[model samples]
Target chain A: MTRSLTTVESRLRKQKPDSGQIPFGRTFTDHMFVMDYEESKGWHEPRIVPYEPLTLDPAAMIFHYGQTVFEGLKAYRTDDGRVLLFRPEKNFERLNLSSERLSIPPIDEEEVMDYLKKLIDLERDWVPEFEGTSLYIRPFIIATEPSLAVAPSKMYKFMIILSPVGPYFSGGIRPVTINVEEEFTRAVKGGTGMAKTAGNYSSGYQAQEKASKEGNADVLWLDGVEKRYIEEVGSMNIFFKIDGEIVTPALSGSILRGITRTSILELLKEWGWTVNERRISIEELYQYYEEGKLEEAFGAGTAAVISPVGEFNWLGKKMVVNNHEIGPVAQKLYDTVTGIQRGRKEDDYGWTVEI
Target chain B: MTRSLTTVESRLRKQKPDSGQIPFGRTFTDHMFVMDYEESKGWHEPRIVPYEPLTLDPAAMIFHYGQTVFEGLKAYRTDDGRVLLFRPEKNFERLNLSSERLSIPPIDEEEVMDYLKKLIDLERDWVPEFEGTSLYIRPFIIATEPSLAVAPSKMYKFMIILSPVGPYFSGGIRPVTINVEEEFTRAVKGGTGMAKTAGNYSSGYQAQEKASKEGNADVLWLDGVEKRYIEEVGSMNIFFKIDGEIVTPALSGSILRGITRTSILELLKEWGWTVNERRISIEELYQYYEEGKLEEAFGAGTAAVISPVGEFNWLGKKMVVNNHEIGPVAQKLYDTVTGIQRGRKEDDYGWTVEI
Candidate 1:
């Protein structure tokens, strides 16, 4: 699919925010990438244009049916001014998987990667120079057909937008508290849990908000069917270490296959650490904690890389892990991952792409 | 809170589609209702505006998080030029319930009803007079906050768009064939199943599309937990007649509380019919079929008030209901409801609201 690229630069540039005050997703770059899809022409007219508001018919299917999917990744700036992206192809691959599940048409992954690289190169100046700050890239597709029929959309708009964001954890590395969700379930087996679609996130607002109000940083969801086994936490994949082994929930058709989770697993295996991917029930975890075998727990995602879980509130009982401090395993994983991301360590895995 | 109304009429009116060719949600009225909500200031600046495209930032929370909810109803034009709405308040009440589940601010039901009435009266000419045609009204709210965080939006836009639509069943009142879904559960017991939000619909598209490809009109979703008990069919609540009694699935925190379903149950109980709302498993229903006790089956929703089930395919075995004909109960319910809506029958239930 050979396509010509068009550029429309912004005439008036907005002032950049201070690095110290940079917030997540509150600021945008000057340019954005867009492409349209029709049943007849397929994806066409790929272009980079000035970032602006999208004009859509009030009856667009996306607003009513929520037929949309999105991906999030960041571009880091090295101390010497080179920009690096950590496993961006994985994000687009997941996006296509989500599109398949939602019945949206697929895009050319190779071509889109080329276009994404061009987009990042064009917006390279927006990449923050601070150690922890980076340019966040959001690639999403929305159903734009103006109809009320409950079916797959005939028209779609795929876009890539850039936002300069501060560190996910502003105050530095800290262990957080999580509440075990017993009433609400995020996704079930044989559902859209594996897909990174908008519906999965929206359905979790109630549980997430409730947890926030109860003084917990996030909610740790259990399996939808039995409600005993651990699934994931908030928006990240969770891992638990018990009896000197790392255990994470296996892909059960209802858990998001986070890239960071996969990378962490690979790193642990390469280091000769015992890693297991299987169902770990809440009862079993509690029993392990009582026996002093549970040593560490953390969440893995693109946003925070690795967020340590210091405490968990299950029903009425509270269990503190590692005395409310970051465990050695969690700290090493975070440092190694972030070090590779910022180009401070050797890229032996060839995970970073320089543009 | 009191909200002042403003009007902006379209300079040029769109040509109305032929009554016979009017497709569902394809054609719109000249004006629409709009309101905005902020964290500090509640819903304010309620107004009627010309039908036009909406401009939103690329990073709006709705596009990424799918924090959207909507309602569907219609306005019928009687033979004597009078317009009637059937239990419009119920739709708003359900919308608030969905708002609460999605962490959105609730709208004043009474005040919003007044605004809806004014908007309907202003566009009264757009209401179709055809027997089976009416003006389809869609009220929706979307998160407008420009952020990529997974939390609920701090800003929202509530709007109502009117589309003149023909009957859902274009040919006639023929029964529809549905396939029993063996995979892909729609919602679970503690999920967002009761909310009429966008995620629920989008997540079911895969199952619906697969059913359509298998020569079925829709998919009959079973319970998400065990996939044994019946839940719903496509977007409607389902009912079955076994041994001369009507049985529908009770609201078990997962099934939608459909207004039409409620009305049908009320009418049946008032007429001295045995109606039961309880769990009905697939195995039990099949057993009743084998004993020749299964008589009638139908689905109820706002679009198609009563859709008879002609046949059901479960794991390649087909069961034809009433020789693939519309059952007597379904026909009667459709007639009674449509007649009351069009003012041709007595308003014994006081459901019709004249505009």
Candidate 2:
């Protein structure tokens, strides 16, 4: 399933640096990997060309209709100066799953992985050597067909773009305050909640702004039906440490199937921790917190990794978790996962992909 | 609230005409209107510039994380040589609501309408007089800030583009066969199902594809929880006629607050038709259809106004509403709505906005 990459030297020569000022996502590598798909031609013309603007019709389905799906992972620079990707195969698999849900054509994971390798090879220098910074690789597919019918785009563009970014949390990791949202819901059962599509995030923005304006860091959504169950945080899958056990909302039809969340579950099981993936209502969590049985609360995802929740505001009432400090379980999980991610320990689970 | 005209030219010239042919979303007008928003400056730098490639960072939020929102409407040319819009103000309000949900800056609707008017005036000649053909306007906002923080973008772009479009159903409106989607949900309660964003539609692609592949014309989504209550049909809001009464899914928090849906309700009520915006479960509809009480079912949207539903497959069972004919109720609704839109009838509701 490997794809043969054709090089574009002219595109590579157009590289310009941003004063090398190491901002989050301001700078980009010279090269990118692109593949196009159509009803007649499955997926053809895999190329490594200069990173440039995509000339799309103003009415392209992606702009107006939002028929798009994206995957996020990182290309890290190790101590030995070799580039590496962590569980990119999982990302590709998840991308296909998202594409299937979005009606976008799926791609071969092996070929995508090979495409990533070639892209990384061309942009190796952009992989930052900083302790927390890495070259962020984004694989996304967007409907390119110029039609307004709104069924599904017959044509699509699959692209891989790289950006060097700093750590998500600027200051030291502190517990964030989250506001429970009653007015808005992110995704529901029989909805696109479980897929990594753009519309979910866009729709959550108004609520997010309300949360931030109300002095909270993120918005926590209740289930759309009863507005009772705790679904997820803004961009991450949430978990609650209760009665010496890790409990997260099950992969109900309405939650994104997060790779990091899945990895955390597997790693916790291997480390002899009881993990429960089931419906965890906000009422139950609040009751447990009042009874001093809720040990820790945090969110798991690729960008933030593991963000501890220090306080949560539910319907105008706020509660601090575990004395407003990072709980022991959260700290331990973060250390174990990040240690493996940074190649600071043994790759017991074979998660890292070496370049 | 009305802004003055700011004009720019088209940088790219026309590629010689291929034939006497027109396509959906392929061609674009010469100039585009853009305004940027920042926290300190609010929203400024409103310009009408040549429609050129946007030099956005590769890590732009819209490309990677999908922080975007959009609206769709059209400028119609009447036989009397006048341009009019069917309630552009409603579209503006919905756009702001969408922006608020997406955490993007909300612009003054009147100012936006003014810009749209100026845009149409400049591209007036592009408006085709082909019966039922009009210039489609797409107003979209995207998070342009180049950061990977996964938070809302600090900067945003509000732009308007125009495209000439023909009839949505191509030939005259033919009744369509709809497949009930049991596995995937388009929108769930408390989710962004209400907002007109990209993620929601993208997520429905798979279901729509499955329906089309299975010989169904469109996919109908049910409630996320029970998968029985009707929500919407693909891109349009649906209506059911039973026992001389009109029934539609209420604003159940998960259903899209469509403009066309609202107009149809008003129009139906004005015409002495009993309109009920309550939860109409699929089981109830099926029971009515079995007893020959279901008179008609159609989807209402700006694109087609109202498309009659011929047959629907529900839970492995099939039901024909009007024997594949355009039901009487559906025909009246469509004729009245489209008649008012195309400036062929009275504007009693004041829904039409003249350009």
Candidate 3:
């Protein structure tokens, strides 16, 4: 940890003071941690440098071929004046999982954790004091090899950059309307669906925009082949409550296994709630709603810890939740998680990492 | 065009050679064409700029959310000493179509073509003067807004970069092995399957790697839900020849409508070959292959004008195409397209765009 701090300090530079006024992702911290990988060297040249533009060949595979994967988490400043990361190890694990699918080299967990801690420590001032705002940390790996051939990149770069962000949902933990997209699938099984890769967001943008134009908040993607099973809502994993039992779409190889999603399941079980991960077809959910057994629905992700769904418009049919408000179950889950994240609740799950 | 040329010249910079080893996308030409879009300004500030690294905030939606789309085309220096684009308009049209599906702002054709001409004219020296090599042009758009919110970006960047590329199929126009991916689907119907977005590529990489490791050149992705019908072959559109008729998967809202694919169909029809755009399931293909009616299969795209497939391993069964060598029909198609591109044949379709 001492060596890591020293390395981070050496790479640190003066950050612009006016960054506070900038919007999320508009500005970066002074220093960034980088590691380069080559087939011969494996992973080498771990260094911290000033955050600047990446000098990549115009034909870099990431730009043209889209061989890139990234992860999003944050460093929060607790009331005790300590910087903490809520389950960052989960993010690290997910990043590697994405890396393996993208054919990028894996990083050592110990070294990566050390580097992340060091970076967060150096950029501690960037963490906002707002209740919902914090310093957003992005760790991404890209194929830096300059080859037009359609093969995995031989050279790669792993980079970490920090940005101060406000709340993920501008309107707070309010419910969101999702347009259940029967037109497009986010990812298919046997594909990189379960991986947190950049391509998923790009592919879902159209549906998202369509949903927004049609007076919805996000696009709810279904299985590509059948177009009936609810897979995900854009970037978040979805959970449905039917008859007091919480059901989430199983990690069916076609949906992202969100970290917050898994945590919520664990928390639900701890709170004595029946939580099951299984195939959740749209027909069953619609039927559950018809039978008045559907209690609530919500989405889970790193950014939006727990976003309750107000209603879902599927194929011209509007299926509203019982009251079009945040369900009590969802509110409790949000409070419990946010409490743990902000250090108000007991950290029994060992999810928080004090920086 | 005059105003665009004048504006473009202001941004042009002299090319700095990076050693003489032309690696794909590693080096760029002197100038890059760029334009911006906003709700107020629409598409404005069209200019050609020095090839440089984009200064993106770490949280730029493209970096985290993958709100990006791209098109690939090429500029060929024909034997007749003319710089011509192989069906540039088709790429332009397809790009906008992809943009519409991806919720990206669509650039006006006149504006884009004007900028493309300016860049090509400035980078004429970089265009390769070889039989099988040309300057590959990559046009892409990314969401550039600084907000962390998950909505359509208010601002966008449209960029065109050039790279000198050699033959796409290094081993010549020979058939390659493709593994039938039973578990993963590249894009799903009612999803962004037809749109050329980054998510689709990243999602397909894992299956592609698995296919290669399993002794196949590429993965033949099936439809998402059923995983039975054949879809596109990653970057290229899949095609089949059976009983002297050409057949391809119809654009059923899930398959990318490749320009080269449509071009080939037109060419086949011009040559009096029966061409059909309809759903042909994998089982039907195998049954046809077993009956000796399936003569050839190929993939069409800008990179590889046409790539012949020699064999397919579908559901534990290995099936071979007629005559492991390039089939007669594929050879003729390839000869026709490349011949037209290299100036060996006349551009009867008016597909070539002269710079």
Candidate 4:
């Protein structure tokens, strides 16, 4: 699958950031993967070119129609200097799912994955050696056709860029406050919620901005229909520990099907814990809090393996959890996931791919 | 804004398409208006430059977060060699509203309008003189900052481009068939539905493509909450003349506030016709059809002044209207609106602005 890709080395490599404290998505590596798709040629001319700016026609459909999809994953450097990727296949599979929903032509996920591995192998030194630092991989496809029609684009561009990111939390995993979003909807039942397309992300920026202004980290998104059941927290799928069991919102068409959420569920199942993927409304959660049955809550995603929730302020009413500190369950899940990702623990599930 | 602009004309102008029959969004004028925004300095550097490709980082927020807004309008060339724009302020005003929702910086409507007139003034010859042919104007703002953070971008780009379009109906205005979309939602309450943003447009491509494959011109989008009440027809506002009353869906927060739809309502009111801007469900519309009182239906937008709806296929059940032909009311409205635009008739409402 990597045979069709041509490689072009950069004349000058960028100065790698200090291995001490790196930031997210601000700096890039020396090279990137690029591909083009046309109605006549399909997807062709795969290449690894120098990291540079993209030249696009002023009327490209991506700037007008928001026809784009993306995926996020990371590559870690273990203590023994081995590079590993966690469930890279899942991200590309979801990327194709997103492209399909946006009416963009599908890609060969396996072939693209092979090309991605080859690119990463060439830049193996870019993966940071810090305990919490890793090289972040961003793969996105954008509609590049120069047209103003309200239909699907006849041309597209697929790209992959690498950036080194620090730990999401500067110090350690700390519980943060969230605003319960009731006035704004994240997605609708028949909308692009289930897909990882760009449209599903920034539409909730207003609510998140308002929440952040109120001294909260993010907002707890509710269902689009009744605005009752919980959908997600910020950009991650959410889970609650209540009634001595784990409960999370089911994949209700309008909720993102997160890869991290699936991994967490599998981990819990292997440990023989009770987990229910069903609708859990804000009202029911409040009731559980009143009865002292609501234990703790956290968000799950690729960026942050487990983000513990400290408090929820719903319309000015507060529900404090675990006395505003990280709970035992969240701590355990974080340690286990990060341990496996960094090769500090045994690879029991064969989830890591080494380069 | 016009005073801040600098001009650079193209040295080699491409031959213009022949005037026999033009297409939509395929050809452009020689120059375009470009502006930029940054946190340190607000929107600046307004210039009319040669129409060329834009150079941007591959990580531009527009491709990742979909934070972009746009508007559509037309410039008409009258028989007297004068160029006129139909209610240009309305489009700019809507563009600002869209910017507010998308969290992008807003531009001065009056100032930008002045700049737009200058751009169109320089390209006056590009506005075709045929009856239905006009210069289609597209004003858009995209997030240009090269970042991957999930928040409002700190930098932006604002530009306006012009394209020459022939009559929407190449021959006579033909009625179109619409599919009632019950499985996919275009927008939802508390969403970006009212904003003329990119995300709200292309997210409906899947449904629109499905409808087109079924031999329908477009889909009849319903309310995102209940999927019952009528919302829109593809990219336009839909109206139904039922039981001697003209009723269109209200500006429910989940529906687009179309400029042409507003003009049509204003004309109907001036003509002393019964009009209702409230929710009208598919069930009630079907009931009206069953009672033989569904007088006519049409879609209102900038590209197509009036797109008559002759058939509706809802879940395999069909309802034919107006004997599958354009109705008298649609024809009259189109004539009066376009007449005022081209200065063929009196500008009774002062809707036309001559350049």
Candidate 5:
């Protein structure tokens, strides 16, 4: 069943930031979408209200047990002023998967999509039309039940908020240096790695902080069991081009199935490129690098369509890929993905939807 | 530096629940302790305010990243009108340890202790005086910075709330049946397992739900890597009395450093009992059971104090322990620990703090 949207305008509208200098997730739109779930009633009272603080009991389960999940996507404003969303349905589908894994009651995907579109329509002005700017959407579910017990919460709150964000690379698309994480593991087999849950992100903070302190851009996590297999880059799916072939880690249940990563794979296959998804151990990668077969390395996610990896430091040995610069493959993939997202390229895959 | 406490009384105090019918964490006291932390100001404005809903931005990091930690302890009201706190310092110490791991700022132990005592004194009437009832204390820290970036938060809120809880075993210490979790592993080395963080608890919800559906009290987690070595239980530390010796999992980086687990080990040592803190595999446990050397099994935690395990079902095979009854060691340990906590027995270890 569809729920009608309720709107409450804010008395004081926040000043819009300059599209050229907009930082990620710091500024929000005037309104947000909210819905509540209870044991007796399903998700109800869908509404778009003025952006404000949420009042919760101190004993809320989200603060203690962390029964929470979230999804990230963006609304793009084309040069011709049409607002488009890139595979928004995929986000909601993943949100449902996360909810089930966390023992939370799932919401109606179509109904939530309607609510999301309504929210974006109301805040359409917040979408930026700059070349590298867009309106980032964050949808999350949290356990709101006021209990300290270690069990599934009986109450939940699902919300969506919008923030104007500038380009990930302000100057240019510069390759980044990564450190191989040997001490800290993000997720193991049969863990919550595949689910876009809060715990999976928090578990990587230590390693990320350590890598940042060591002058690295981010950490490249290894498998939890053997610490040999390459899992993923920090918050993004990783890809390597070795011997003129593109390879990415398979969905081993411990790596997030990124939407951008999926699109990249589809695009690669369409371009008649050899692409493989399987276990890629660190030793194998080093061997390829030693043989000068490792041509390019990059990370893919919604935030940065493609972030090239220039250097990798594993256990004190440094290996530079593609002479510490972006390779042809990474550049082409970036251009193709961004072109389709911004309506500059043909929508052969029908991945973007006009709202 | 110590901060002065400010008090704001509630206009409408809630009706106190009957101690005999108290449910864990469902009901809270009239007041709560609150403190705020900023990167520049550190922790400030320590106060005891009326228990009310906390207002937070919907994009708070705790909701999306799970950057939160919590500690559980209790305040017991002795028969002679004295409130006793068992090893409260230990909880705060562990809280600091958790903070370090999660990249959150640490709080002053002495100052927070002072704040906790003030809070308990204000709500001392809420402490249950029944034989198996006590005022449960939950102190937690959550990232409050309204940012969507996957990084440590700059703002935080530390809170302590009180809940009157009845005995964990309301049916007079009946042994519980446990299911050995093989498919869903809990935590692995180099993970956030040793810390009292929210992610660790949330990650176990799936396994716990599966066990509950299959008619079990809780799931007994194994090491995340091999899934063979025994780890902690759902919310407690597992212990076994096999071949006349007490055994528990060593402090592998993936198991929590439980406060109750420490006390139990100390008591066992003081009583001249053999206690081994090392890896104990499921195969070794089953071997002991087959040889009739498995004497008892129990779980240790703040809430339960001590809970005996009647049976363990591993891979469709069920093994009964101590003839499905509490062994002498488990009984004695429970009585001794509870005695020390409630001030019924002599406090030789200075574990109790008076407020």
Candidate 6:
């Protein structure tokens, strides 16, 4: 943590994309934050260097055994011409949690946070200022050992990269139909389901593709055990409103503890709304809908603050909610979360930090 | 499949490792097989080049989403100086199976096997001729698209690397102790456990470390749903001999279809042994041990041809098998498989291809 940071600026800078044309994760900034870890030296020689490709041995452990962890958060550009980061420390802390589950060696989260801030400050101009546009930050660690051993690697490389991203929904927010996935299992207990590791993301693609082919926007994954209880949807934590009560699945070992989910819970508690965090089965959800009690359903995650669910397809049964319209609760939560992120709403808690 | 293979010989030929001193997965050969896949041209430009590091974009999908698959096989140098590959085509077939599960674009298995034969022929000198030594072949495919999207990568790179591996049991073939892991799950029915993908290996390291700390050689993972049915042990498929019969966990969607496991079943069938491939629960295994019906237990995989299980610890209960020594069945299987691999025993099946 005491190592002096080094900086190497790029000689030629890339032209920033036009305001409205910015894509998600396709374009990068000028520089990136990098650090290497060895068993003897630990994490050392933190540097901010020009964005470039990574050169690694073909037998690097990451290429064979996927011993890697990643974290995602965004840097917002406020209307007042100031740059802000929303809960960056939480991302670093979660990254460490992910590393532990994958058997990766521990990293000092505080020092990495400091290094991330320095890199963001140096690339301040890359923070898109257009409405709903921000710089997406990806901090990841890959095993760098040039060996094909099945065990954890002794060497690692930690890096933080910036990507200018446009809005999640370029058009107005709309509700999406989600099929209750009964065939594929995303995560199970005592697995890497809760960790923000690499494997968890791509494993869900086949299910996602199936739902897309069936005219559904995403797949609402059920619990891996009995395939009855609700877990998550796509890459987000899910919530539902029934009979004026807001409910979300509890933090099961197989469910990811989303930062956006945490923020929404805090907001809901402050608003004094009736909320419950417990197991909810798909049968019960449908029963409630038949009884005219089901109100709204939405997903919460970093990618989309609140992805409203319009319909649920369980087996061949189709159940519609909110008349296929975005509910008021989903709209308010999205606005409040995005508002706080962009520094437009009052920062009651220490959520957004200015650089 | 008719594309002619190209070769680029290495100018700086590195010295091969000393016999009997070779480590597992380290000390690569001078050249390797490489190919690229793009949406436009498909898998093209199959060439063999010097073994070197891979230069990839930082935003490569493999670093973010873990979309990759790999296979492991070995080439043995017969006593007559002929390099023979044992069932190399099966490895390529399984690699495609793994690629399907990970959503990676598939490659023509026949074409890849042809390219691998050429690479191994060129690196023939690197094959260790010491007793119990062989050339390890690792064929891996990585998602190479330089984007952070959570989907199947459009660009990919498939490469085959070679390493000279020493004998698995360099000292002598000794029985290993394994633990029945109750707290961790290796694979569930609907996950990537059936696929030899990158993520499945590292995710089990924590359990492996726990077992190692408890003075056990590896972990015996159970099914994820109930954590009762036997799944796998470390990275190998497990088999148990009970009441004069051999049994292994059925390939019920979560268990890997190991090549060694397949060959053992064929050999057992030819020998007219009573072999059952069905779901085997931990409770039944312990009960059989209590009744003195448990005879022999061993792990089947590529690294260790026949890893005998002398002891098993299941929730604090220790059950010693075959009096802490390799069983007769395990020894016979090992000698038979390795004998055929080394061209010592007659191979009735067309399992080995000589170059």
Per-residue lDDT for B69 in model 3?
Answer: 76
What is candidate 5's lDDT per residue for B1-355, written digit by digit as tens?
A: 5687899988888888765678889999999999999999999999999999999999999999999888999999887889999999999999999888898999999999999998999898898888889999999999999998889999999999999999887865778999999988778888888889887887788888889989999989999998899999898999999898999999998888889999999999999999999999999999999999999999999989999999999999999998899989889999999999888999999999999
lDDT of 5 by residue, A1-355 (tens): 6877788888888888865678789899999999999999888899889999999999989999989989999999888898999999999999999888888899899999988998899899899988789999999999999998899899999999999999988865779999999999899998888889888887788899889888899999999999999999997899999999999999999899999999999999989999999999999999999999999999999998899999999999888999989999899989998888998898989899888
Q: lDDT for model 6, on a 0 to 1 scale?
A: 0.91
lDDT per residue for candidate 6 within A67-184, as digits (tens), equals 9999999999998989999998888889889999998887798888888889999999999888778899999999999998788899999999999998887775788999899999
Predicted candidate 4 versus true structure: per-residue lDDT over B1-355, tens digit per residue: 3447788888978677778388789799999999899999998888999999999999889989999999999999888999999999999999998888888888999889988988999888899987789999999999988888899899999999999999988774789999999999999999989988888878899899889899999899999988899999988899998878899999999888998999999999999999999989999999999999998999999988999999999999999999999998899998888889989999988899999
The iRMS of model 6 comes to 0.6
In angstroms, how far off is A94's CA in candidate 1?
0.6
Q: How many clashes (backbone atoms < 3 Å, residues ≥3 apart in a chain or on different chains) does model 2 have?
A: 9
Clashing pairs in 5: none
Across B133-188, the per-residue lDDT of candidate 3 in tens digits comes to 78889888887776555667888888898887767666568899999888666777
What is the TM-score of candidate 6?
0.99
Q: How accurate is candidate 3 locally (lDDT)?
A: 0.79
Residue A337, model 3: Cα distance from true site in angstroms = 1.6
Error of model 5, residue A258, in angstroms = 0.4
RMSD (Å) of each candidate, 1 decimal: 1.0, 3.5, 3.5, 1.0, 1.0, 0.9
Candidate 6, B17-76: lDDT as tens digits: 877768789789999999999999999999999998899999999999999999999999
Q: Each predicted complex: what DockQ?
A: 0.85, 0.52, 0.49, 0.86, 0.85, 0.89
lDDT of 2 by residue, A227-332 (tens): 8888899888999989999999988777888888998999888889999999988899989988998889999988768899999999877779988899887888
Evaluated on CA atoms against the true complex, candidate 2 attains a DockQ of 0.52
Compose the digit string of candidate 3's lDDT tens values, residues A1-355: 1233335353446555342244556667787888888999887777777776666655566765577788888887778878889888888898888888877789887788888887887778778776787788888887778665667789888888887877777656999898988766677666677787777666666677678889998888887656777888887899988998999988877788788898899989988998888888888899999999989999998778899998999889889996789999889999998888888888998989988
Question: What's the TM for model 2?
Answer: 0.89
Give lDDT tens digits, candidate 1, residues B1-355: 4578898878888887766568888789999999999999989889999999999999999899999899999999998999999999999999999999898999999899999999999999888997689999999999999998888899999999999988889875789999999989999978889999998897888898889899999999999999999999998999988888999999989999999999999999987889999999988888898888889999999898899999999988888888898888899999999999999999999999999
Worst 10 residues of 1 chain A by lDDT: A12-21
Candidate 4 clashing pairs, residues 3+ apart or interchain: none
Residue A135's lDDT in candidate 4: 91
Model 5 scores a TM of: 0.99
